[model samples]
Target: MKRINTWLISTWAAIIGYFQFFPQDLNNLWQAMPDDIKASLPPYVAKGVAFALFCAMLIGRSVNTHKEKKVLEQKVEDTKDDAAA
Candidate 1:
């Protein structure tokens, strides 16, 4: 379980970190649009939005997992205490 969590966190971190480095492919994707469309926004804005969504999901999942693990740990401890008593 711990190993899984470690791996997940590392994976998310790596993905987010990689995106932080500006890439040409994403720029191309953004620039391949028509001029009228391009006039509406900046290039990095779209990338930023994508990164924000990705980070949100990653953080959300991490928090939920941490909460669940804590709850389960507490339940286990309580059960052990009751058994001992």
Candidate 2:
């Protein structure tokens, strides 16, 4: 699950970076979207939704990193104890 989450976060970050660096390309893509789909979402609302999703992904990644760090620390401590004994 962590691997999958990391992959998804990396993919999303890359996509966002591409759009940021290539606004003209993004604009062209947006123009190509179906009118009904575009009309269904007010621009601000769409931005807000995207922002919320990005925040959620960031938080999930942070939590996973924290958990992995704790597990690694514990393993290191266990190894030290075994060596000492």
The best candidate by TM-score is 2
Look at candidate 1 and give me any clashing residue pairs. Answer: none
Query: What is the TM-score of candidate 1?
Result: 0.54
Cα RMSD for candidates in order = 4.2, 3.8
Residues 1-85 of candidate 2 have per-residue lDDT tens digits of 8789888888877877786688677667778878998899765554456567878999978988999999999999999999999
TM values, all candidates? 0.54, 0.59
- The models' CA-based lDDT, in order, is 0.76, 0.80
Q: Give per-residue CA lDDT, model 1, range 1-85, as digits (tens).
A: 7677667767766765766675765676677988887898887687777777667867877898889999999999999999999
Query: Which stretches in model 2 have alpha-carbon errors above 4 Å?
Result: 43-49, 62-85
